[model samples]
Structures are given as structure tokens and as C-alpha cells.
Target: MDVDTAPKPAGPLLALRGISKRFTGVRALDRVDLDVHAGELHVLFGENGAGKSTLINVVSGTFPPDEGTFQFGGEDISHLTPQRARAIGISPVFQEFSLVPSLTVEENLFLGREITRGGVLHAREMRKRAAALIDELGFDLDPSQRVDDLSRAHQQMAEIAKALLGRVRLLILDEPTASLTERETGRLFELIARLKSQNIGLIYVSHRMREIRALADRVTVLRDGRHIRTLDAATSTDSELVELMTGRKIDLLFPTITHKPDKVMVDVENLTSADGSVRDVNFHARAGEITGIAGLVGCGKSELIRAIYGIEPIASGTVRIDGRPYEFPAPRRSLKRGMAYFPANRIVEGLALSRPIRENASMTALDLPAFAGFGVLRQAAERIAIKGVMEQLQLRPPNIERPAGMLSGGNRQKVMLGRALTRELSVFLFDEPSVGIDVGAKLEVYEFMKRLVGTGAAVIVVSSELPEVLALSNRLYVMHHGRIAAELSGTEKTEQNVLAGFFREHLLAEVA
Candidate 1:
């Protein structure tokens, strides 16, 4: 049979059959099945803890299923190792940053398979290849630049370029545009379209409905470790896709904000950083209101927030809380003043992934009477306190003994929020709190934030997603070149207006 008339085999280019995995009574994948075809974009959609990640992990060789068979290219490869999976043309871009921070772009790109002559590595050839790759993509990044210094979007592009350097037949991208700007996402889509023309298969895993609608050719919905439905992307709406994954109609993804804005809670004047990432920034967060800071990557938003939270040294400026001068030389000092912060990278700065939920949740409130006993951490008391928090947050399994790492992305975020809540904080700072979570989970986090503000705590959210900012914030501030360029509140807080203001200044200058 010819390639076109081969009856389009009933299976898939890759297929999982009767896959099952269990960890301590939790069925991560319960006889689940999925299929992907050549020259098609397959999307996996599910809420957090619905076993989507487990299914991908099993297929990518991160782990093996207890009972199942994996057929790739009509061959049984059930027990292949991760290295073997990659060798056979399977590539995965994980949500976590996998680049070597200390290595240069050229070195990181060709780390495992450096160009060599006579058993010696050829540095010149590696640099030339990296330069060519950067030029081919029309990116202005320097090949010699250290990976650590590159912006998050540039780093992600480098990862994609590295994967393309190999003989990849199947590409699995997990939240590839979670932090990418609109322009960068457009460029990525161009690259993906180019790859699709060559008959390569793509498995795109993302929580953004917009991206799925634009890129996916076929969509698969998974719920609670079971394969729910597979549909043609052209025939499905975002609401329909979401309902399939969540098993319910979601009228509003963002919760209604009910808290009324009152007095100013956080006031900063002429805040400056030594590196010039943040220069003479001034802003105030109002009590019971969500003040969002929107900016492009490397625009110094994080640095400014760090200075406010006392993680970064302030070169010159004053921070005041309720008309009182607040100078915090460390994060502990900031916490002592009734302020809480959820850092951008949850795995690194937010939680002790290997620690149990009880320990991680109680870490921020160890000094409280409920969890402290005679200068010692009261284990029983801590568990009791965490139990209440877990219930309030709607965490699954409800087991305090599970390691934080074992939970899903959404659950881990909840753990971080739980930690912050334990502090009795009057001011809350959330930095990209919904980065890698599912759409349904993102809604839950937004609702939780609304409830937090109902207690009169002022909230500051720094996010790259413009829509999220428009939805959750009562007032929005766009940061450009380390300064607030535009502020929109009330009826003026539309996505178009915010984006127009952002581009009017930056885009005009670029064109001129």
C-alpha cells in the first residue's frame, strides 16, 4: 500500500495501550490510551492531577508503566530508557528549565555531542553552528552569551534550537509559551508550521486555550487518569474543549472581584537597584485591591518586587507601610512585617519539593502558637493546622504525609499559597503564580486570591500574560524600561487598551 492509500492505520504513529501506573495507592494512569499521528499536532488537555503529566512521563521514558505497551512506528518499545527514547527521535521540552545556567549558548546547545576532530572537541565549529542557528531564526542573540544572562524566552528558543539539531521525528512541548510574548509565540508557531510540512508529529501540552485553538490539529481530553474524548480541533470551541477536560461548564474562568479598594497599603518612592534593572521606580498598592505589574521579560519587574520584599538591596528609595517606614534587609524581616511573597519559580524559590506537605505548609508559621511548642516544632500541632489549610484550599488526597513534589503543578501552587496564608499577612505578592498550571486550576487560584483580598490584604500580582492581568486586577500598571508607563483602572481596564498602551511606546520607538 502506498503512503497515501495505506488506509490510515486505525492506531497511531505512536500509541499507548492499557497503560497503568500506581504510586502508594494513587493511580496516576489507569489503563489509559492515547494516540498521535504523523504530520498532525496532538494536544493533551486536563486539569492538574488528572494524570496528563504521568501519561507523558511514561511515553517519554521518564518512567515505565506497571502494565502497558507502547507502540511507536509499529514497533513495541515498552521498556525503552529515556536515552533510548531520545535516540529514536522523540524529544521533550519540559516545563522546567533544563539548560545549564553556567554554560554559554553555544556550549549549552552542543553539550552532549560537541563537534570533534581526531577525538578532540572543535570549539570553533560549535560556535559557528550555534551562530548559524541563531541567524536562521532571525534572532539577535549572541552565541557567546551565557545562558544565565539570556531572557526566559530566548533561553526557551535555544532549547528548541537544540532539539532541532537532533534527528527528531516527534516533538513534545510542555507549556512552551507559558511565558512567551505574543511576538515570540508567533515566531514559534512559524517554526512549528515549518516542521509540520516535513511530516513530523507534535504533541503540544499547554493550558492556554488560545494556543490550542491556533496550533492543534487534533485534541485529546484526559480527566482523572482516563481518556475522555478526542476531537478535531476545527470542530471544537474553547468552551467545548474545556468542558471535556473538566466535565463541567465554566461560565467565567476568572472569579468576580468583590473587595473594595481603600487606603494605600504599600508605598515606594524612588526605588533603585544597583544593576539598573530597576531605576527610581515608584508605586503604591491599595488595600483590598489587586495591583498588577505587567512587563516584558527582562523589564526589571522581578527586581523591583524583590527590592520591595527585601530580597534585593535598594540603592535609593523609601518603602512605607501604613505611613510607617519599612526597611527590610532580608525576606524574614519582610515577613515579620506581615507581608508574604510567592516567587516566580515554585520549584526553586517557593517550596521544599522533597518535604512533606505538613512541613512545607507549616514552615512559614513555625513561630505561631498553634505550631510552636517550647521552641520546638510541634508535629501534631503542625499537622492539624495544615489539615485545615488543605481543606480550605481543596487539595486532593488530603494526605499530609505526601511529598510536595508528588503533587501536580496546581497543587504545588496551592501549597505555596497555603504557606503565605499561614503568615497572617496584610500584603501579598504573587509572581507568576499560574505559570505551568491548567486552565481550571488557574481559575481556582484566581478565586483563592479574591478570597484572600476579602480579608483586607493588599495584593500585587506580576504576570507576563496580559489577559490574566486584565481579568484579575482592579488596577493595572505596565512596566517599561523599569518604570511605570501606563496605569489603567476601573472601566479602562480592557486588554486592548492595556496592550495598546504597552505597544504604543515600545513599538513606535522600534519602528522609528
Candidate 2:
């Protein structure tokens, strides 16, 4: 093939042709073609099941392509193993991190590919090398610090640092900035620029269009396991990209709804965790409003909510639902009291992905008379009970027995919401519900939140996206270092104000 030759056509550093993959009855990719050039950031845009993950996995050697070939530096290396993939200078940073929580940054940096002598670990040299790498990347992190102790942003940095440990020529990042703040995202962009300067090829997979505009040299769209088309990023509009990705253009990202909060539903006073990660947290959610919580990644927003749901043990707190005291370390107790907590990662914590929708939805109502006793699921009764919420949330295909994993990002969330709706609730706690889903999915989740709160149920939303919080919440609280820093409402519900609140303590300390 002319592709495998010296002086490779000033073209792609890596080129994939006619790639196809199948799993069971599902054809994940079909004749997908992609090209990534050295010194270029190539963006792969696709909706769920569009073959983006399959293609990347093929390149990363997670699995072999059933058909087609991949050329690396002009050589057809289609049937390569993961070791060979790394040996040839390809490193991938996936959305779910691989860093071990128990290990230090230095230890994790050289984990499997460690420096060894006399069949013993070379800890000192590894630490030195890791320290140098962190410094080179301009990351503010201590090499000796445990991975569990680091903030999400710092953990992300550590993930990158681990990937760059080898002679990396092509770096693939999947949703790298999904959890990062604006400032953190800027820093990542700067680092990417530095890598690009070294003539390294970059495959950046992101749902955020702003990232593509800011970084992409070219954009490739995949649809239903086939290559749709590739366009120059500079010339492509977001609408055009959306059309290419979803096959339909959505003009509105969010639906407008007036927020009218009524009487208090869930009230917390002096909430503090044993670890002090969440300290003296005090807030309230009204019967008909979204109480938004916004802060940087490490702040106590997550822990504070977890404390209320009885997931995180509270050292001192008073939680009241409908003006009555509530207890901690008792999830069933909280659930029975009409309080539902939805986690950010729906796949792992929120729902059993492999299970049928019937089981997932009915899990919340196991204590209900129709679902209890005999230790066997009353399938017919369960379906009838969950049918209303499922229809209301508009789960695609409306298949009651579909596995939760088969649904798209948006539908998966709806499944969680459906389960929540089945239970009578006074307070609904959502933590970053709109993480990786598309615009349409986000609007659906937003609509669900509105509907739930409209039924005289209180909702507390903790999101990193300031616009989302502002749009969904009637009242907002910003946390910094385990405490509520500022509370905003009405005219004060601006992104700028929320950010100010996020850094209020730091600003005060700096001023002092």
C-alpha cells in the first residue's frame, strides 16, 4: 500500500481505514475511516453508539478491529496489542481514571512500568523522575501525596502525567475537561499546546463544542458505526457539527422555566462531617424550588449533599424533612422519609447497568406493599407502578425490559430519574446530573427537575456548570473549604457572582 512508505505524504501520523467492529448482535463500527496528523489536534465528534469509543479502543488495543487497517507512521499496524500500542508511542487518558487511590503520585506514575534493580523497586529514582515530570507539566502537586487526597483537577493532572511517562508520540484524551473548572481547562489547553509544539499528534474526544473551537485542527464525525465526514475545525460551525453528529440540529440547549420556590421542605442546620470535609453546612430546599450548590471541585458541595442523604456520616447536624428531624447512616430510613439522592455517575452508583429497567426502577419501591414479600419481584405490579414515571420522562423505545446499559447517556439518567419518581419524595438531591449527555438529554433532565419540584418536592442540585445551576435553581449556595461561602438569589444568580462565592475565602485571605 502507498500508505506504508518512507516520507509519509505530510499526511496523518496515524490513519485508520475501513475499520469495523461488532459485539454480539450490535455492529458498533462499520468501515470507519479516520486520520490524525502530527502537530495537529483531531477532534472526534459523535453521539452515543456512534462508534467513537470503539474506534479509539481499537487504536488503543483494547480490542482488534474485525475489518480494516490502521497505519502508524506509514506502517500498517492494525493487529497490534496494547503493549505494542504503547511501544509505538500511543497513550490514552480515558474519562474514568486508572490511578490507584492508595498509591502516591510518584508510585502511580511508574506503576506497571516501574524502575527496578535486583528485582526490587527503585523508589528514589522513580520519585525524582515523577517530580521532574510534574514540574515540566507546570502542575501544582506534591509527588508524595496520595492519589485519594488530591482534588479532581489534580487527579486529572496525575492521569496526564502517568500517560506522558513513556515516549508518547500520540496522546488520546476522552472528555478530559468534563470535571474541570474554567481556569483548570485553560491550564490543560496550555499543556496540550506544549505537547503539540513537540510535533505530537493529539486525538481529543469531547462533547463540549467550545473545546473543539479552542483546540481542534480538524473534526471528524461518526454516526451509527459509520464515518459521516471530516471537516476543517476552523470552517465548521457548531450547528454543522451537531447535524453531522446527531443528524438533527437542536437550536435550544436549555428550556426556560420560571423558578418559584415555596415553603421549606428539607432543612439542615450545623451539618458537619467527622473528617471536617463538610463543616457546619447549613442550607434549606423549599417544597417547590431547586437549591443550587456551586463551587470548585474539591469544595464540600458533594460531601454536604452526601451527608444529607446519609451516605456520608455526619458528626454534627440536624436534618429536617417537613419540619421533622432526620437521622444519618440510614439510607433506607432517608428513602422511606421521601428523600431521594441521585449520584453523578449513574452507571456505577445510581443504577445497575446490566439489569433490566424494570428491576432498576422498582428497586426504589421494594418496601411498597406491591413490591415486597416472598423475596421475588412482582414484575407485573412493578411495571404498572413505574409506567407513569417512565412515560413522563419519555424513555426511548419505552421498552420496560431493556438493560439500563443499552440506553444513551440521557436515557440512562432518565432511568435513574424514573426510579426516583416512583417514590414519594419531599426532597430530591442531584449531583452534577448533566455530566456527559448531549444538549437534548440535558434539557430532558432539566424538565424532569422542574416537574419534580413543581409537584411540591424540593430539589438540591450540586453542579460544576454555573449556567446549569443558575438556570435550574431559584436559590444558590456557594461552598468553599467545606462551608457555605455565599448564598445568592434573584439578581445575584449570575455566573460571575457564583464564581466570586467559589473563591470568596481565598479572596478574603489574600486581602488579609
Candidate 3:
């Protein structure tokens, strides 16, 4: 496809000069400057808490910048409201889903701008247009389907279709492919290419290095809430980009697992879920080893782990912890049996976002000897304990008093992991522990997991990213349709082997 060569404007299509934002005296964005061309796929790279999101928020008019000048299409748009920004051709697809669950795809697509005849909404016309738009995007989705029933990937597609319906001069995609499969991601890239051909400017934010290389024309790096540097994507390597974003060399993102596999810490036999999501699942997580669970979405991997963690009810199964048969009817029951679970939705399930960092970190270990005094909580001792965990995890802005909600994605993850580390546990269940975290923090997490294994703790990690599972696990299990379809150990655990197993199960089912 030929590059779109539209008439060049006098100034940048969008420019942010000396942007600064503050939250309770914290300099979230400090004198940041950025520029996006008219038809360029400009990538924004930053570590967690480096102020990428804050900068985008300021640009998109989600938050009024304390100090900055935002120029767009030859006008100063520094203080425009979010609605006004959207009206003037700036749309954003945030990390979180923004669609209303109860609304149908047609309603979500043309939500506020439904076709009107005689001052009445034309539902029939809106549906027809939405169906055509869905077809144009090559997505197999019904226009009348409720948004709540669609998969996350499909919801994301709906968001892209909605953005395309507007006069979108600049489309900002924040971690757009974070939850998509390789095939779905390819379709998204194709759509992005088509958008670029129409001279639609794009500001792409992602942690995945491969996506940036494939989609970006130029790159901007931010660190510690400041603009660090800008470079042409064609001239940058993944390592170089990592160095720029992190300000240090990242030799190994995944630490070497040295702990030998020992006794089985958690054993699940014939576990099944009520929804039939998981059936006859069997696995044993060994002490001092990282056992990984990998599968495509809806493959029963999450259900299998949740059942063991007591988050989901089990139909017929026996869970043994250290050779003791146990009935884990609740999370507290599992916790009391020396089991810790770091849920995938950390913000929602793992931490108390409204509470202070120290409280969240020390919640599980409050009754410990060090944190307890005369049958009461000792505030001083709790602070000391939480501080140690923060230092070990390298949580940025390491303030124990800050609300967990105010921390960046990586730091929030650290707090979640800190909760597990506070209590002495024999088994740890991690569900997508590094989902929204940055590269540097991911390395820190990898090292922390290795350290936990070194201390004779068993670890079970459930992840959708194949590289993360292959890089960290001592044993790998691939699940398909509620059962463990294949297990790879020692020299057999490779990406090719896992993919082959995944596809082979599909082929067998097709034949059957």
C-alpha cells in the first residue's frame, strides 16, 4: 500500500508543548512535548508510571492540563472538553471497555448520533447502517447482539468500528491488542493500514515490541512523566526501545528458573466446573517449580485454576494440599491452607484500590507476629513490613501512604504480588500477573517469581501469552475444551510444540 501523501499542514496535526499535570503534588507529566503528523502511525513508548497515559489524557481533553499548549489543526485546543475534542476528529480507544453492556451493537455504534427523521430516532436506518459497517470491517457479529454477550475481542472490534464512523482525524489506540489472539491482531493491523491510507493519524500505545515495529512509522519515548526522546521506528530495535523507555539495559526479561522440581504442593484430581467449562481436569503443582497453564480463550484453563483456588464451585474433584485432602469452599479456606492467589483482574479482585498501599500489602499478614501487638494491629510494624515488600518489588514512587488506585499499572501489580509475598505460602496461583505492566516491571516480577520458587514455594501461572508461559515455566500444560489436551516437559516445551498441540486438538474435533 502506498503511503498517504496529503497536503502538509503548517504545524503538526497535533502538538503538545511543555505539558505538565499534577495529582496531589506528584508530577505525573513534567514538561512533556509531543508531535504527531497528519497521516503517521506514531508509537508512544513508556514504562509503567512513565506518564504515557496522563499525556494522552491531556491531549484527548479527558483532563485539563495544568500547564501546556495543545495545538491541533492550527488551533490551540489545550482546554477543549472531551466531547468537543471528539467532535473535532480525535477519538480514543482506551484500555478498559467503554461500551454500555446492555446496549446492542447498533446502539453502541451510533450511540449519540442515531439517524433522526422528524426529530425522532430512526432505529431501522441505524440498524441497517450498523450491519453494513460491521460487514465492512469483516467481522462476523450480529448488529442486534447485546454488547454484554460478545467476547472482549469482538467488543474491541465494535469500538474500532464506532471510531471509524466519526470524522476521525487522529485515532488513539491504548494497548489495543492486549487481549487479542495473533489472528485477530492481524485483522486489526490490516484495518489500521487501511485507516492510515485514508490519512487518519494514529497514536499507538503498546508494551509489545513486535506490534510497534509492525505498525509504527515513528516512535516517542516517555520516562518518569517526561518526554525522553523520539526516533524513527525503522531505525530502532526492540532492545534499543526498551533501553530508552526503561533507562537501563534489559538483558533478560525472564529470569532463569534454577529451583529443581520437588514434592507436589497442590494436586487436583477429576475437577469439574458447573458451567462445563472445565471437566475431569487433573494436575499437580510441585514445590520449587513454576507450573504454567496455557491455552486460547475459553479453553477451561482459567476455570481449572479458579476451581483449585476455590473461586469457582467444583462438581466432583479432590484437592490435596501437602497430602491432606481439603474442601476449599471459599477463598479464605484456600488461604488458610497456605495457598495464595493473585487474580488476573488485580484492580477489581486483588487489591483495595481506595485504601492505602500499606494496608493492601499487609492485609493478608495482619495477624502475623511482627504486625500484631497485644491482639491489635501495630501500625509502625505494618509500615516496616510493607516497605520491605515495596523495595523488593521495585515499586515506583514507593510511598506507603499513597492510594493503590493512584499508582501506575506496574506498581499496582507489585502491590498485588506483595499481598501474596506477605504471607508464607506453599502454593501460589498467578493469573496473568503481568497483564498491563511494563517491560521493566515484568522483569522484576520474573525475578520475584524465581526467588519465591527458590524458597521452596510452588507456583502455578495461567497466562494467554505463549512467550511468557514458555519463558517462565518448568512444565507446560495446554488445555482445550475443559481438559488437559497435552503436557510438555523438559525438552518438549517449545512454542512450535504448543501451537501444534493446540491446532491438533481442533483438527481432531473437526474430524469427530
Candidate 4:
């Protein structure tokens, strides 16, 4: 699976000239030329469907380019086979990992190509080699530890180690730090620097400017399957990159909210998750207000909201809807108290991807008498209702019959939000609603949230992006270690305090 090839000179390690790829009637990539030198980090920037994935796939030998000249160390590698690409020292680590979770770190490192003697299994030899590689990469990982037990950061590192199992000269990382927390991203960046020191050429594909600014040496912009321009990382600005990718200047990413909050709609006291992930937390959300929850990953912000929505079992908690005590896991009991939750992942937790847009948007109304007559859905009524919501959200080519999965990132989110707004709900829970959506769509969503709160409905939003939360929310609750660490309102709400709240328990522990 791997070849021990000598390292070439520190010149143009990989060159792609006039690369073009097509899928059906769409041109995914068009005559894009990229040159990556040894010990350099080349970043690919684009919008969600901007051909970055296609280019990376071609380079990794998922398929050969239709028209292009690809050179590796000055040697022609055009139309290279996948196995040949790997053997010749090109390894790709995609956003979705290829590691088997049940296997150990060392076992996954040399998964397909194992160390064996006389056709017998050699665990010791494989473990030793894996440990050596882990040490060389300066990673703190036990080779024998199962990948299921590893954190997301460690799992990512394991995938990288697997890519470097052979003579790895060129490393391609596709959104390597997308799922990582702030600290995990920092660790991954440090590892990338170490690889750079070893003269490995890295091609990074990401839409996030923070990652690009931190890692990119030179950035190549792609728009509508065409190479716009390649700019020096040091000279490029976020606005410039946005302008190039979208062909428009977005002066504001988040819209300002002037609406005021009214009466308390949701009130919780001593809430705890059944799994003990979320500790005792007292929270409140008033009608006509957007209350934002801020925390790092695994800080129990999501669990707290889930418990409130009856999606998670509450161990010990008292929740009140309109000041009336509501029991956990409602609807089984005769309580009409409920909340609409928009999960972070629209495809997985939010939308039924294969279902029609009308059905997905009108799913909540299945029990309502307006759309559901005698439990059978009235197709005409559902279509008419959702089409109106789609127009309000400004969904492109608004056709309710289309599948939810076929839409772009922004449109898909709009479809999901439409489902929530179509129903009658007292509180709305949005977890990272603006993630992976375009600037125009993000603003549209924000405006919709303002209008929703304007209708006397309480909105509670959970987001990792601090600026959006600060800009849109009427109040901020920062969670730390399964509990509410700080409640910030008015001038007390700052990014520093909200982010610092993530480390509040750790800081307390350190001082003690």
C-alpha cells in the first residue's frame, strides 16, 4: 500500500496545470493551475459548492482530471492511478475519517498494510512501529487504545498518522479542523507546523477564514468552477476573500435586533441530564427575546436545551412553561408544553433528507387539523403553506416537491427553519443555525429570528461563533463544565468573558 521513495528536491513538489473536471452538465473545476512547493501550505478557498472538493478528489486520485497536466516533483503524473498516487507518496485525509472505531490506534495506523512475519499476525511489531511514528509526530497517544475511546482531536491525529504510514511527501487535509474545538484546532495547527518542518507539501481545503489565516502560505480562490486568483496569505484580508468567493461585498454578516423581550415563557430550576452530562442549571427565556447560549464543545449547553425540549431525559429538574410546572418527556403525559428544536446538523438531526421539501416543512403540522385531516396529510394545504414560508425565506427556485437533500447548504437550512416557523410554538431552539450557510442566507436567517421573536415567541440559540451570538442575542448565558458559569446582559456581554467562561471551572481547579 506504500512505497519507500526518496525525497525529491525542495522545488515544485506538486503542480497542476489546466486541470478541468466535469460532473454531468456541471463543470466542477475549470482549468485550475496550482503549484505547491515542499514545506509549504497551500489553501483552497471557496463557497460551499465552489469545486474545492472536486479538485482535492482529483489530486488524491478519486478520479483523473478530464484535461490537465499533473506533475509531482517535475515528473508527469497526469491520469495517475489511486494506488500509484499513494505509493508515490500522496495521501489524502478527508473530513470524514477512514479509521475503524473498534480498532486500536496502532492497528488503524497500519490497517490495510499490516506488519506480518511468515503470513502470521504480528501485533507487537505493528505496535512498536506505531509508537515510533506517534513519538516522531510528537503525539501523546497510546497505540493500543481503541479509536472509540479517543477524543475527536486524537481521532483526527490517528487519521493523519495513517496517511503518513508510508513515504508521505504530499499531505492533503480536507477541512481537518472543522469538527475540532478551539484548543483542538490549536493542537492540530502545531502538528501541521511539525510536518512542514519535515518538508511535506500540504494542500488544505477549507471555507473558514480563521483556519486559512492560521495555516495558509498562499491561498487559491475558486468561484463557479473557475480559478479567480491566488493571493499571498500575508496580504489577503477576510473581506477580500469574501468578495472574491461571492463576487459581492457583505458589509454586515449579522443584522441588528432592536426588539425587546416580554414575559418569561421558559423557566428551569436545578435541571440535570439523565446521563449526568449536564449538571444543575437554572435558565430562563422570555417571549419576544433571543437568548443565546455560548460554550465550547462538550460544555453541556446542547444537553441543557435538549432536556428542556423533552429530547433528553431529565434526572432532576423543574421546568415551567408560561409559569406552569411542566414535567419532563411531555406528550406522554397530558401536557401541551413543547418547543421546536433546530439541531446543528440540518442533514442528520434536522431534516429527513430524502423527503420532499413540503413534507419536511409541514411535518410538525401532521397532527394539526389545518394540514392533517383525519390523520392523512392534505397535500394541497401543506404545499400551499410551505411555499409561502419558502418565499418568506427567499429559497431559490422555490419548488416544494424537491427533496431536502438536493438543495444547497443555505437553502437546506432555510427549509429546516421553515419547518419550525410553520408550526405554533412558544419557544424555538436553534443550535449553530448559521454554520455552513452563505452570508446572504445567514442574514436572512437572522432577520427571520428577529421577526419570530417579534411575534412574541422566545428564541434560544446555541452557537460556537461568539460574534453572531453577541450581535443577535438579547442576553448571553455562558456554560462551563455542565453548568451555567456566567449570565451576561447589556454591557456585561463580551466575547472575552463568554469564551473565558469555558475555562472557568479549569481556572478554579488550577487556583485550588
Error of 4 at 445 (Å): 3.6
Write down the RMSD of all candidates, one decimal each. Answer: 3.2, 3.7, 2.9, 3.5
Best by lDDT: 3
Report RMSD for candidate 2: 3.7
Give Cα distance to truth, residue 24, candidate 1, Å.
Answer: 2.3
- Pitting candidate 2 against candidate 4, the one with the higher TM-score is 2
Q: Would you list the clashing residue pairs of candidate 3? A: none
lDDT of each: 0.83, 0.83, 0.85, 0.81
- The number of clashing residue pairs in model 2 is 0
Q: Candidate 3 deviates by what RMSD?
A: 2.9
lDDT of 3 by residue, 157-208 (tens): 8887777775778899988886676778888898888887787889999988
Error of 4 at 476 (Å): 0.8
For residues 1-512, what per-residue lDDT tens digits would candidate 4 score against the true structure? 13334574756999899999986556778999988988899998776557777888888998789998999878888667767888788999976578899999988888778878999989888888888888877666788999999876688788888898888888999877655677767777897897787788899987677778888999998887789999999999999988898888889877767757899988999998988878889999999889999888778888888888777889998988888888755432322355778877676577888988888888766777878787688888878898999988877657778887766677888888887767667788888887766555677789889888888888999987788888888899998778898899998889887767667766985787
Clashing pairs in 1: none
* Residue 43 shift from truth in candidate 2, angstroms: 1.5
- Model 2 lDDT at residue 509: 54
- Give TM per candidate: 0.93, 0.89, 0.92, 0.87
- Backbone collision tally, model 3: 0
The TM-score of predicted model 4 comes to 0.87
